[model samples]
Target: MSYDKTIAQAARTELERRRSQAQETARLNLEGFLSRCPRAVEIRRELSSNASEAARAVVSGGEVRMELEQRKARGLALREEYDRLLKSQGLTRRDIEPQYTCPKCRDTGFVEGRMCDCHRALRRSIAYRQLSTGLPLESCTFESFSLDYYRDDPAAMKQMGIIFRTCREYAENFRPNSANLLFWGATGLGKTHLSLAIANAAIEKGFGVVYGSAQKYASAFEKERFSREAGEGTAGDLKNCDLLILDDLGTEFPSAYSNAGIYDVVNDRLMSGRPTIISTNLALDGLEKRYSERFASRIVGGYAMLGFKGRDVRVQKLNR
Candidate 1:
């Protein structure tokens, strides 16, 4: 459940921002309250002094019982006066206090030296948001995916219905070590939509998901290869994310380095038992020819193949 350092840092920044906002708001509230009710200032000062006098009486170690009782009564009277002033001004103690987003952590993202649930949720949200950039995650949901596109052909419709159900179930039951999936078919057959739907579900369940076109990853891989640094970079994230959705797999600019990079990513994820969903327009044979028999074989042996059917869905939409 490790997160990217950048994402962790962003979450920390967000928590600090919330904390600062709460404190600043409380400061302004107190300033305004004191301005409106000037008497509250003297009451607050006396309340502070009364508490200090009680502490001093305790430490004096003499027969200070009478003095302590007197201080306690005075403190109570001061508090009552303060409350009356607040009531007159239509304010409460909370109105002058910091209203932290997470009262448990006081917006600090931690409690008693352990990370808080709110912090973990923030990190997951930030990770999902960063990974889902450039994706139509909001629109490509299972609810929005229509089976009507395949209605013209009963066989296509039936198969697509099953595919849709399977995809929905897969997403609902998705885990970090769930089985791999390969979506193979012609363009505009809803492969990308279903894969993104799975990604959205996984993200909602607090799993880190990395999703992008193959070309986007390929270009990143190529760029990282030529860089001076010798770190995993994009390959690490692709292989290590809780779920990886590689879309349009055969559309990348093919080169020796990019091809090998792609193979390494696919192979490494497979070897590590990490779940991946790859959507490709290439057929099994085309995949073998484009990459290598080894790459295609890895997919064949380790992945559940879902063949998308129907005419181009984009064309169908345009016609309708």
Candidate 2:
């Protein structure tokens, strides 16, 4: 999949950070060990020089073997002296070598020039974090949702309570192949909150989540529509994210271009069997009027619908 350049760069930056950390640890430990065993200073310098000489000796034919033998003899003698010296000081040979966090990859986040699994996972996590920045995510968790705001009306309370529970369960068990969901309700009724809660959960599971309000999507679509070849396109990523949460549908300025673009993104995801959670104030018929009959069908066809019926939580909370 094509990720944003910033995503790939962030991944590389993270790998570099890990590598630097590993190197720093090695340097710090080496420095500490050298401070304890002053004789290791000589052996370290000699070994470093031998490493360079070993490369040069590769071109010296049989003389390389003779040089290698001499280096080996000297190394053995140094090791013996160091051991005896450490015995007196109470330390081992390993106590003087550079220590690594990962012996297999050495905290490089790669092997054979290919990215490691840890690196890929980190990139996906970073991407989700990047996308969700400044989004109102914390207010929407199931724990924050309350049914008291629905009113004492038994039917409304029961319906809203069930809806709230269903949304909570859905978000709790969310996965890439999880079922699509529609959150239909009036504004301030917790639609965005629940969708964001699910997004938070999905991201916690290491899934890549894409979230944008209808206004944001429409604005981007309009910009992309006008500048077809002028800039990068993010539409594909929107349609292909592991979980897509499109909030505040029906709020964007209506336009032919944005209308089609919106349909394409939602429809493509639906057809591809990718999970999407759309929170719209528009009811089924209103959805048909603003979008299309086919689009409305796509939402209700196989996807589950959660109807939010509570009064404005913001208003009720403020009053309380």
Candidate 3:
């Protein structure tokens, strides 16, 4: 999957930071151990001297095998003594070794010339974090969503409860092949909230999610279309993200390029079976007029449609 360059860079930086931190921790641990047990320092010095003496005996060629065996036995004894010292101080050999975040890669982000699973997960996390920056992810969780807002109308409340339950279930069971969702409703009907909540849940489950308004994506497309920046294709990131949530779909300024771009993203994700959630103020008929009959039909037929009905809760909140 394609990722934003900045996000990829952030992941690399994180791996580097982890490597440096692990090394620093090991350095500090060794320093502490030496300070606590000066005998460990003497043992290490003796081991080094034994190695130098073994090299000298090899050069002298006088009973080198016997000399090497004696040096090896002495080195083993010193190692045992070092371990005893460490154990006396409530430490082990591992205590002075670098503890990498990813044992597979040792925080190097790669193993045997291939990207490690930990590195891929880090990239997904960075991409999700960068994409979710301006979104109200923390506040838009299922727990924070209120059925109290629709209480004035019983039918609205009931439908909203059902929608809320379905959305929660969808997020709970979310996978790469999960069903697409089309949230069609007026503004302030909690479509964005539920979609974002799904994004949050999916992200917590280690899915790569990209959530943003349709207008925001359109602006990105415009920049990519006109700019000279290399390898900065926003459409690729949107299409390849594990889950894409597009809010206020009908609010973006319509143009031939943007309309086609949006269509391509929707169609590509649909064809690839990558689940998407689109929250829009447009009905099926309105969608047909704004885009094309084929695009509208594709959405209406392929997506699990949820028509939200309620007064604008933003105004209600203001009055309350």
Candidate 4:
């Protein structure tokens, strides 16, 4: 999957930083160890010289095998002595070596000409972080959501309880091709909160998630529409993300282009069998009136509706 240049650059820079830090840390550790144990330093020097001698013997071609075998024996003895010195100080060989976060790539972000898993993960995380910017992802978890705000009406309480449990289960069992969801309710009814919770879970499970308010994405689509350049848009990210969370679906400024763009995104994701969660203040009737019968009907048929019923939680909090 392709990410924006900024995201990719940031990931690469971070990986390089990790690699340098590991090397610097190892160098410092070795310096400290040498300062404490001078004899170990001498043994290390002897081992280095033995390796150089072995190399020279290989090229000199005078009883090469015997000379190489002698050098190897001396090198092995020097190594044993070095190990003994380290053992006396309660240290091991690896203690003075660079300990990278990923041994496979040594924090280089690639191995054998292929991008490392760690590198891909870093890019995905950076992209998700950028896409989810300004949203309270850390605080919008299922555990932090309160049921106390829905206590005003019995029907509302019962409906909210079911919605909470169902949302939690959906997040827990989320997969790439999981069922699409429509969160229909009024403002502050926990629709956005639950959708963000699902995004957090999917990200933790290593799925690439793109989350944004409808207004934000609509503005992106509008901006990208006029800019007729290759690789110059956010729509690709919206369509290709493993999971998409479109919050406040009916809130964006309406236009022919924006509406069609939104419809295209929804339809493309649906056609590709990718899971999407759409939280909206619009009910079925409101959705049909705003978009089209086809758009509304596609949602109605494909998405499992989770009706949110409760007093405005934000207002409740403010009152308290």
* TM-scores, all models, native as reference: 0.91, 0.78, 0.82, 0.82
Per-residue alpha-carbon lDDT of candidate 2 for residues 1-320, written as tens digits (9 for 90 to 100): 23456777887787677767767765666576678778877876887787777777887666878888887777778778767876676656555443444455655767789767777777778877786678866666778767777776788788887877787788788777889888898888878777887887877777778888888888888877766653447677788778888888898999888888888988888788889888888999999999889888887796788877757778877888
RMSD of each: 2.5, 5.1, 4.0, 3.9
| lDDT value for model 3 | 0.89
lDDT of 4: 0.88
Candidate 3 positional error at 193, Å: 0.4
Worst 10 residues of 3 by lDDT: 1-10
Minimum summed lDDT over a 10-residue window in model 4 is located at 1-10
TM-score of 2: 0.78
lDDT tens digits, residue span 210-282, model 3: 8878898887787678773655477888888889988899899888788888999999999999999999999
**Tens-digit per-residue lDDT, 1-320, candidate 1:** 12476888999999999999999998998898899988999998998988998899899878689999999899889899988888888888888899999999999999999999999999888977886677788999999999989998999999999999999999999988899999999999999999989988998898878888899888887777768355578888788888988999999999878899899999999999999999999999999999999999999999999999998999989998
Tens digit per residue, CA lDDT, model 4, 40-62: 88888888888998899888888
Top candidate on lDDT is 1
Candidate 4 — which residues are off by over 4 angstroms? 1-6, 24-69, 77-97, 111-117, 120-132
Q: What lDDT score goes with residue 248 in model 2?
A: 87
lDDT of 4 at 288: 97
Angstrom error of the Cα, residue 130, model 4: value is: 3.5
Q: Which stretches of candidate 3 lie over 4 Å from their true place?
A: 1-4, 25-73, 80-96, 110-121, 124-128, 228-232
